[model samples]
Structure formats: C-alpha cells, structure tokens
Target: MSNASRFKFFKSHHVPTLTVLKAAIGDFSYAPHAHEEYAFGVTLAGRQDFFSGGQFHRSPPGNVILFNPEEVHDGHSGGERALDYLMVYAHPEQVKPLFADVLGHERGADFRSRQTLIQDAPLRQAILELTRLVTSQAGSCIDQENALYRVVERTAQLGGHVQPSQVTHRPEALLDLAREYIHAHLEADMSLDDISQAAHLSKYHFLRLFRQHFGMTPHQYVMNGRVNAARAALDQGTPLTEVALRFGFADLSHFNRRFKRIYGMTPHQYQRDIAR
Candidate 1:
C-alpha cells in the first residue's frame, strides 16, 4: 500500500491460463513467499533484486527472471530508482496441456527452470509481448494463446531439468477430508480446532503438516475456497450482497478487501471486467 509500489494485474477471458503483473517499485520490499505457478519476469527499467534458488540476483533492464512452482523468494528495488517489470504466471494445470507437443507431459511436468536470472532477448520479447496482449486485452484468442506458447517454449528451452526423483509425503486422505470439511462449512465460523479435529489430528501437528504439504495455512485454504466459490456464484449473476453472505465473509467491506487480495480486483470491479 506504499506510494513507492504499484501493481496492476490483468487476466483475460481469452487467455485465462496466464495472469500478467505490471509492477513498479522503489522503496517497498516483498516478504519471502512462493507462488503455485511458474512466473517469468522481465525488467523494463531500473534495477531489481531478489533471492531464489539459494542465490542473490540483481536484474537490470532487459533481464528475465524465472521462478519455478513453490520456489521461495523475495524481491525489491535494487537502488534508489524504481523497478519497472512485467511478470507472467502460468498455472501447471493449464500449462501441462501446452507442454504435450513440445516436451511431452512426463518430462514437461518434471521440468524446472534453472536460470533464476538471465538476459535472453527472445524470452524477454515473448514475455513483453505477452504482457502487452494480456493487459491490453485487445487480441484474438489464438493470438493470446500463441504468445503464451511462445513464451512457454522459449522458457522450456532454458531448461535445467532432469527426470524428477521419487518423493514421499503425507497421506492425502486426511487432507482431502479437511478440504471437504472446509467447503462443506464455508458459511460456518470454523476454527483451527474444528478443521484439525475434522482431519483427526492434533491442532499443532495438523497446522505444521498442512503448511508443509500445501504451502498455505488452514485458514488461508478456507479463505481461498470461499473466494473461489464466490467467483463461481458471481459468474451466475448472483447479487454481490448475496454472494458475500453466502461465502461467510464478515461484511461487504471485508468481502471486498479479501476478494481484491485474491483476484486482484474488488467484486464490483471483477464483475465489470467479466462483463466487458
């Protein structure tokens, strides 16, 4: 919310698979966080600094930054000047279909980007054009999809992936039950004990294991589920007030703030955009 930072997010009905972020930051700093999607960033002006893959990086103009899914990192401006950049986020569920032709599903899903920082003219161009298409919202569906694929392919070419090794983690049934409980009781005032009890685990154990497995807390998961359900209802022309109440938001203002945080727009703004 600082004056030194700004973020504009754009997602199109034509290309729902990718979300574009246009950002300019000077004094603000990002807390360490990771995304569930692949993110590619291009620096347009000034300098940007971030840490990822256990390395510190400074990206100047014309540089591209790549972050794989669940890659923990933080970012901010590198100097006195603001950092102008564009980032494209591609979800795995959407991107997996695109990789079938280029790298096959098995290899592509396993693929990880190794270059956290680099200067690649082709990749940078694709990303810039992608930001243009998504933000402008003035291109054909085919055009947008083509641009997305071009970026994905160029990114895949910068590969640092091998056959992913086997891994073991928590049992899915407990988490599945927990998620079911959250969705089933969206309108209820659920607490940590409520959810963890539904999962049949101790509160602290469930909290730790859930975050480790899902990258988000139990409350965050519930909020996300509620927002997503609200989105669906809005698409059905449900009244804003009804949608908020149905989703268990504290009030219209609370709904507005939380929805904006999740979808990058208030409910009213989102409705208007979808209408357009």
Candidate 2:
C-alpha cells in the first residue's frame, strides 16, 4: 500500500456482522456497487464525492455519507488531494437492535437513511469513535458494543428514515418468486424475460418493482448472488475455477472482477487469506 491508494479492512468481533475500513485514495476510483449492509462513513480529510439515489453528493471533512442497504453508488477522490475516510458496514440485523433504543422499535423495521449526505457533528463523532474500537482492536466487548450503540443512535437520530411496511402488497409475493428464480438460475443463463415470466408479470413492471423492493436491478442481484454463492463454495475448499464455473461466471477473469467488487479481493486472495 502506498500514499496514492491504500485500504485496510477489519471485522468487528464486538459487533459480529460489522465491518470497518480505513482508506486513502488518490488514483483509484470505485466501480458502481452496493452492499447488503447499511453503510455510512465520515470523510477524515480532503473531499469524497459519489453518486447515489439519483444525484451526486460531496462529503468533506466531518460530513457523513450514507447508503441504504443495496443502494448503488460509485466513488472517487473529489479533487487533487487524496481522500481519507473511515467507513463502517452493519447488516440490518446488527442495526435493528439499536433502533429499539433509538426509535422505540423492534428488529422488524426496514431501516433506511434517506439522505445521501448528512452533516451532523454528533454523528461524525459517533462514527469516528466506533472506528477506534474496530481498527485498534483494543476494546472489550462491552466497550465496543457501547461505542457501536452510540453510533447507531446518532445515525438514526440524525439521518434515519424507515421504509413503510406497506408496499404494493401484490408485488411482495411476486418479488419473492422472482428473487427465488434468480437464485435458482444463478448457475444458468438468466434473462429479464425469464425472471419476469417466473414472477408472472411483464418485464418492465417486474423490473421496476424488483428495484423498488430489493433496491437493485435484477441483474445486479444476480451478480451479487453469484459472487456470494461462489464465496461459499470457496469456503468449502473448492477450486477457484470450479467455483466460478459452478456459479455461472463465464471464465476466471470474469469471476475475479466480480468477486473483487464485492469481497475486496480476488477469489484466489479470498480463498488463500486466513484473515478477512
């Protein structure tokens, strides 16, 4: 790693599903991507710019960049200076418990941070403080949990928006069917027409509703599913080429690119690395 571009990833044992990253980027730009986790970060220096939720946004020092689960975005250093930032990713299950204390709700709610960029002093402090525990790995479980809880509360208090439970009811069942079809066919060539047919809807409406419910296009969902399933196969000591083929990746190079986008490493790296 050099000053031009560097990244360090850590898994937070305290919050089992929480992952943290500290990065400085100058030359590299991130591909448009999304995660299953609710993600937010604070710019530590320089400026960070990205597009999400239909608009471009900037996060300078002390500003928060928020992304709801599975929301697509691409990022890059905003100016001549390298971008320094700290990001934390937490799954819905990890964040839901905090909502009960923050918003008086249980884990059943769909948590969202509606704004793409938020400026809040308390939220920034909370985010930075939580990263201390994750990166340093010096805190007890209780200490780490407390720091994470504060971050979650501050985030919800400042930028949180919940998706309404009532959606177009008819679509929910149909979306599930479409999702299943996508997963089942991940090892095969899949098309919008094929998924829509499985869901019993026209292609365009199915596309719209799929994005509305899953926060990603069906194609994005398929790619993510393929990468995820391939990761699982790798875990079971499968060969990289076989894993890629089984998951329907056209070839090793294609699999490598897709895997890196999601897991931050090539399939070979992920398989060989003992630390994640």
Candidate 3:
C-alpha cells in the first residue's frame, strides 16, 4: 500500500487504542479528509482556522478541538505564527467499551461534537503535561496513557460546564480511594478478592468497574503499583529481596519476572540501568 493508504489503515486500526503525536512545523494546510477515529487535541501555540461540519472555526492558542471520526475537515494557518500542537487519535471502539461500562450507558452521544474549546489554565496545563508525556521518548508508555486519560477527563469536565447534561459519573473519588488503599497495603499479601473488598465491589463487578474507571484491571493496576514502588525502592538502594516482599510478591523470581514483563529488564538490570 501507498503511504496515504498506510496512514489510513493505521488510523482505522493497528495503532494502539489511543495514541498522540506532537507537531512542530511551519504553516501548512491540510486538505479536507476524514478518519475512522476521534481527532481530539489542543492548539498549543499558533493560529489556525479549521473548517469542519457546516462551518469554519478559527483556533488559537489554548483552543481544544474534538472532531468525530470520519468528519470532513480542513486546516490552514490564520497568520504568521507557526503551529505547534498535540494531537491524540483515539478509536471510538476503544472509548466506547470504557464509557459504556463506566457510565452504564449503551452508547455515547456526541454531546460536544466537532470539539469543545477549553481555555482554562489548569485544563491547559494538564493537556500540556499529557502532550509532553505522549511525545517524550524516554517516558513510560503506561504513564503517558494515564496522562492522556486526564486530558480527556478534563476536557469532558470543562465541556460539561457549557452543556450541563454532558457530565458522566465522576468516579475519580472512588478510584482514588482504591489507589490509596493499594499503596498502603502493597507490602501485605493481597489478592483480587482483597482489593475488590477494599473498592467496595464484588470480585467480578469490581474487576470490570475498576478497568472502566482506571483503564486497567485491579490486578494490572496493583502490579504496576508494586512495580513503581519497587523501582523507587531499588533507586534508594533497597535490597532486591526486601523490595519483593514489600510489594507482596511471592518471591524474588516472581517479582523479577513481573518487573521484566513491564520494564523489559530484570530487577538488577533495571537498577544498573538507573545507575548508569
């Protein structure tokens, strides 16, 4: 396939469920086109006029834009300032499962079609942070993915203000509590049953709900939590065995396997890498 076809294919599928690209370039105009994925992003620093749906909109710095998949749109600079922005391409299929499960909705209507322009300082800062994480090569992909969700959450919150009925269930409170519990109990032997009880949900229900809320199963979340803790402990020169026991792993071998699975390196190697 040609480059254009390849781009289209990736946009449709094969790319990660949600991914981002940060652009820095001179003024350029993109002819009208559409993709079968959500095109949502922030106009970081520059001026651009985008024509979408039935009208033309000029987007400047701090403008948040969201366009539905396969929507016809074109972009051209408004003036001399070069455009630099962060763009996240998300598959509706990926978003659909989470929203459906979390908000107890069958389908998500386009409450903010095309895009909701967010200009709040805190919201903008959060978006920038996500953009940085997404575009940075050295940062962890898991961390970047989580940051991307924050951008989405903030966008939804701000947009909901303009359209009062758009806000979905704000379950961050519950998720935060569960996270704190996991951190406090990392050194103790805990199972999915234990965490489910802490989250105040039945085992199967909690597994699905936690994934919907935090974008990962409780097991994956705790594994990641422990891995992060182990990394810090190792950095502080904690012994490998202690780190394993502190994180509730069965043994050093088990912890090492999981650490390698996530970080692609053994615990000792990770330590050496950090030292280097």
Candidate 4:
C-alpha cells in the first residue's frame, strides 16, 4: 500500500500561547530536534516510538507524552500502519503559571521527568478534548479557554515540577499596537518588519511575543484576518474572485485553500450552508 500522510496546524484564540498539531503518518520519521517550548501529545492510533532524554519511548494508542522546553527528541512510526496523533506546542511562560495554580504554589517549575510519558486514560481524554477545542472554530472563546486551563492543570498534576517564581507576561500595549496594525492593513500585503516596527520591537522578538499573545504567528494572524474579511464579503453574495482580490489573496484558488484549511469547507460550501 502507498504511504498516506497529513499534518495540520491550528491556532487557538482563547489559548494564544499554544499551537495545535494534528498528524497521521505511515513512513515518515522525524529527525532529532528540540523545541523551545513545551511539546505535549497523545497517540490516537497504531503506535509511535521516539528517542528522548537518554532512552527511547514507545507510545501506543491513548498514551500521552510531554517534553519540556529545549528537550531533544525524534519520532517515527512503530509499525506498518500509520500513526495518528494530536500535539500541542505551548509556550513555557503560559504553562508555568498554570502549573503553579495546579500545585497551589508560587514557585515556577518544569515537568518533573525528562522522559515523561503517561498511560492514564482520563488525562488522555482530557488532552483530546483540549485539542478538539483548540482546533475547532465553532467553540466559544470562553469555553476554549476554560478547557485549555483544565488540560494544563491535569498535565501538571501528572508530572510535577518546582521552580522559583512565575513568568512575566509581555506588556499589553505593544501587543495591541501590533494587532491594530494588522487589522488596519488586512487588505494590504503586510510584512513582519512592518508589524514589528508598529510594536517598536525586533522582528524575532515581536514574532515570539505575537505568538504568545495571539496563539499564532503574525503571518497567521494576518491570513486569518484576510480570510475573515473574505467570509464577510462572500456572505454578502460577492463573487469569489472579487472576494479573493479584495481580501489580499493572490487568487481564488489560494483563498479557497486557506478558507478550507481554517473552516474545513470551501467558499462555495460555506455560502451554501449560510444560505440554508
């Protein structure tokens, strides 16, 4: 049989400090790499084996894995069948406070174990729920936020950590300025430099802070805004091509792909559903 694979990234409005990944792979293997943020995931089907810390880990269906910031790891399918899973990469600053709240202490901490893997079914289910909320655009922001908190709390309880103090959040005004620039230029081809300038910060620093506060990168935020604008124009019965051009999309096909990625439906389908 031919190998089939898929990977998707989802941005959460409520949990702006986390980005979700959904993947199914048959033959792909990940090279050893380290993330600057916390990586947590649960295997849903087949099996996945990975190398981390000083040893290897085998994660079967329903097993959860957690990697602290800068933890080195590599992943591959354990069998012929594809492995399906959902992963959430979270900013440590965002997770640490929640960890403190779960432990009812002010000390900062990381996961207790470098080789963190759990077989708890209930926590696995909770992770799945949080993944669904973050990936689904239908949920209210309040609901998504509450679910995210609960999932983090559960994860912290499972793998204990102890640090000294909480992480400080970036100033709100800078983030606001960056967002204001994005909204004002939704129909223009905006660049990272432009957005960073609006925030009066370096591009790299601005990119990190933007993702922490928005749950997505600056480019993603701009694309989302453009798609939202396109949706509004379509809802008014505008032609697809016109809508695409008006929203700064290169063409109708590009607009359709982005819209489908975010909303899980093409523009025509969306219009039909709204009409009904």
Candidate 5:
C-alpha cells in the first residue's frame, strides 16, 4: 500500500450540527463503528469497499455511500490506488425537516435503508455540492443552507421510504424576524446570541429552527449579507479596499479570498470581466 495520504476531521464552523471528513488513504482499514449522526459521502477517486447490511459493497468514483444513524459498517481501499472522498455527518434535526418537506409530511419518517449506495448523477452532484459548501468558508449562508436542503431532498426522494406527516407546521413569523435583523445589521458584528434574542429564542433552539427555516446559521446569514453588499459595491467600481472594509471584512486579502471562493474570481478580475 502507498503512503501518500491525508485525513481531516472537523465541524462546520457555520453550521455547528454538521461534521465533515476529507480523506485520501492508500492503506488504511476502518473498524466497525457507528455514528450518532447520519453519514454520507461521495467517492472522488479510486475505489472503496465496505461491509454493511449483510453484504459487501464497492463504491467507485462518482458513487455515494449513506448510513443512517447507528448503522454499523467498515471500509477499506478496494485497490492499490488511494481512496479520496469527502464525507458529512449531520445531526438528525438538521436533516429531518428536509426529508419531511420532500415527502410532503412533517413527522415520523426516517431513512429506511441499512447501507445504501447511489449512482444517480444528479444526486451525486447535489451531495458533492453540499459537502463543498458546508466544508468551505466561502459562499453566503443562504447558498450553503440551500445546498444542504437540496442534498437532503434528493437523498430522501431517492431513498423512496418517506411517509407523509398528518399535519404541517410553519414558522414564518420567526424566520422573517430573523431575516430582517440579519439584513439590517449586515455591516455590524452579529452574534448568535444577538440574532437569537431578536427572534426571542434560546440559542440552541434558535440554531435548529433557523437552519430548518433558512438553511443556515445566523453567522452564515450575516457573512453572506456582507458578501452580497461587497459584490454590489464592487459592481459600481468601488475601491476594493474600501468595499471590503465598508462591507465588514477585516482587510483586502480576506475580502479577495472570500470573493474568489464565492464568485470564482478576485475582486479586480470580477470588475475587469464586468467592464468588458
């Protein structure tokens, strides 16, 4: 087995209920262990073989693997080439509502598979996008939150086991209040406590409801608001440094990095493109 490998494990800074793993392993095997959160991943390259649900399964590039909470499984490289992939472990609360929405219900349905492998191109792309957004520091909170919803919606639809809830509940008033506060304070230092207070919710309850309602945390919402404001200013030929500071970024380099990550170009490049 080759030894050129890397592994990283971390939580999403913007969405605290999410955890992420990015790994490239040439010679490692996992012991049978279970997670308290739902686990899903996409194979970026190479091959991985694992045992679950009374059978062995192989996942090649562009394939997806899913495990419901507490499902036991083990994995290893299926070939000499390293296995490169990004995996997400999400809390049940973060996913349940999306599943409910997709199924046209509001309660009592869960992913009904033991170890599921998916090869649908669109679903794979959605999962990849969700991993990218949740694990990256760029993009607005709304973008990340929407991407997350897409992943859950696609996954639940593909699974084909969602049951409709008897009643539907909406929290529009609270969500609107939160949005109003976030937009009004785009240039200020917005904290979870402050945003939650504005919504008259406890921090924990606010995080869950906010994510379910808007698909992002308060911090992500504020950051995205700032980025959007910066984009508008840049479009009008605002000086890059002034735009960055005026929109709440600490400095020009920080703004440049964030802008490139979200818009796929630096501020100057974007301005040049717009001019032509």
Candidate 6:
C-alpha cells in the first residue's frame, strides 16, 4: 500500500514498546507525516532542522524534541553539516504512567507538553546508552532489559512525572500497546508486516517511521532481543538445541548460525566462554 494510505493508527503486538535509532547523515529529510502516538528524540551530532507546530526548529546535539501525538512535522539535515541523532517512539499509555507516577495526576494531564530540550551531559550520555543497548545485539537479556528500563525511568525522571506508566492504562489511547505486545512475544515468529499491521501502518511506512524514530528496524530489534535471551539461557547451561526451540528458532543449526553471527561464537563455545 501507499505510504499515505498506511497512515491509519492500529493496536497490535508486533510493534515495539521502545526502539532506538542512531543515524549519521550529510543530509536527510522526512516529509510530512503524523503518528497516532507520541514521538520523542535527542540530537547527538551536528544539528537537525525540522518544521513542527508551524515553526522551523534547529535542534543541536544535547537538545531533546518531543512532539504530541498526531502532530504534523517534517525534518532534514541542517546546513552543510551532517547530523546524527537518537529517537524513541512510545505509546501515550507507556508515557502517561510515568507522568502520573512522577506528578501524581489523573491521566491526560500534560507533563510539560510540546517538546523539551535536555542539555545535561550526564543525561545525554544515559540516553545514548539506552539507544545503543536497544540497537546492539551483544548484551545479555538482563543487561538489555535493564538498559531499556533505565531509558524509561530516566525519561520519566527528566520529564518530571510521578508514576511509572502501565502498559494497560490507555489501551486504545496510543500505539504503545502494540509495543507491549512485541515485548511479550519477542521469542515467537514475528514479522515487520505483523508489526506494521499492529500499528495500523503498511510495511513500508512502518519500516520508515520505525527506523526514523527508534533507530533500529523492527527486525533488528527482535534479533537483538533474541540474542539477549539466548545469552542468558546459554550462560545458565540451557541445552543448545533446547535454547533454539524455546526461543522459537526452527532448529539448532539456525540458532547456532544466528548466535555465532551476533555473539562471535557457537552456542556451546559461548556457554564455555561465559563459564570461565
């Protein structure tokens, strides 16, 4: 389907609860589009120029940008310099609890609405680490989940919210429910089309926005998650073949191939190495 035609919002399990993308470009431009849920990110290198809320914004590294759901916006690389940035896409439900927990308020109350720019060095570094962990396939599941947790918790803290957002509060309020679905079923056979449909987007548009916002495509996110899960299982001496099937891989060979590709060693070797 056409990109525009896929603009409708949806709720499904294939979408990411959180995804991060890191991009370096001489020039990049995103045409007008609106998400059914909230979008937020930080520029990490050079500058980003975008039109949001009827004004042109030039965001430099260390600046955060938060856009309300369904806000029309466009973006491009600024000036003659290249740019790099990290972005996160979340459901209102995911974010709402953070605000409620932090602010102790009823749902729908704005938590410093519009966009926010974070210039603190320590905060910037922490955000970058979350993005890195989400995109990288190297970390253990415990490490990766902790990293993701940090991202959410820190964002809540920085945004000054009182409560941790629950996955169920706004089941129909935003696209985050779809993300929760992905998190719960990460080990199963999942597809981009499946995720796109969950978000009420076509595969192409979903891929585009998913990459733009999260920094990693849905496939990469799933692979990274699987790698993390496998690491924990392997470290505990789960049988290689069983690990493969338990994580929904087709067989031991497929699992071994993927495990080696991400971890730089066979499953048995990985277990042995980790045991040392």
- Which candidate achieves the best lDDT against the true structure? 2
RMSD of each: 4.4, 3.3, 15.6, 9.1, 12.7, 12.6
Candidate 4 regions off by >4 Å?
109-115, 164-276
- Model 2 ranges with Cα > 4 A deviation: 1-3, 169-173, 183-189, 208-217, 228-246, 262-276
Ranking by TM-score: 2, 1, 4, 5, 3, 6
What lDDT is obtained when candidate 4 is compared to the true structure? 0.73
Local distance difference test, each candidate: 0.77, 0.79, 0.60, 0.73, 0.71, 0.58
Residue 27 shift from truth in candidate 2, angstroms: 2.5
RMSD of 1: 4.4
lDDT of 3 by residue, 1-276 (tens): 111100000111122554554554354455454444566667877775877666788788887777765455667556666776666767666555443443345543333353545456765776667655544433666676566556556555554312243334445555555767887887777787777777676778777777766545677666777786686688677889989988888898999887755333578875654443
**Candidate 5, superposed: residue stretches over 4 Å from native:** 162-276
Q: Candidate 1 lDDT, tens digit per residue, 131-195?
A: 88888887899998999899888877876674343433344568767877987998788998999
Any idea what lDDT model 1 has?
0.77
List the candidates ranked by lDDT, beginning with the highest.
Answer: 2, 1, 4, 5, 3, 6
What TM-score against the true fold does each predicted structure earn? 0.71, 0.83, 0.47, 0.57, 0.56, 0.46
Model 2: colliding residue pairs:
none
Where in model 1 is the C-alpha error above 4 Å? 1-5, 26-37, 49-58, 67-78, 110-118, 160-168, 171-189, 197-200, 213-216, 224-243, 259-276
Candidate 4, residues 188-263, lDDT tens digits: the string is 8888999999998998888888776665667767877777667667757798888888888788789888886544
User: Which 10-residue span in candidate 2 carries the lowest summed lDDT?
Assistant: 1-10
Model 6 TM-score on a 0 to 1 scale: 0.46
Model 6 C-alpha lDDT versus the unseen true structure: 0.58
Model 6 collision count: 17
Query: How many Å off is the CA of 28 in candidate 5?
Result: 1.1
Report RMSD for candidate 2: 3.3
Error of 3 at 163 (Å): 16
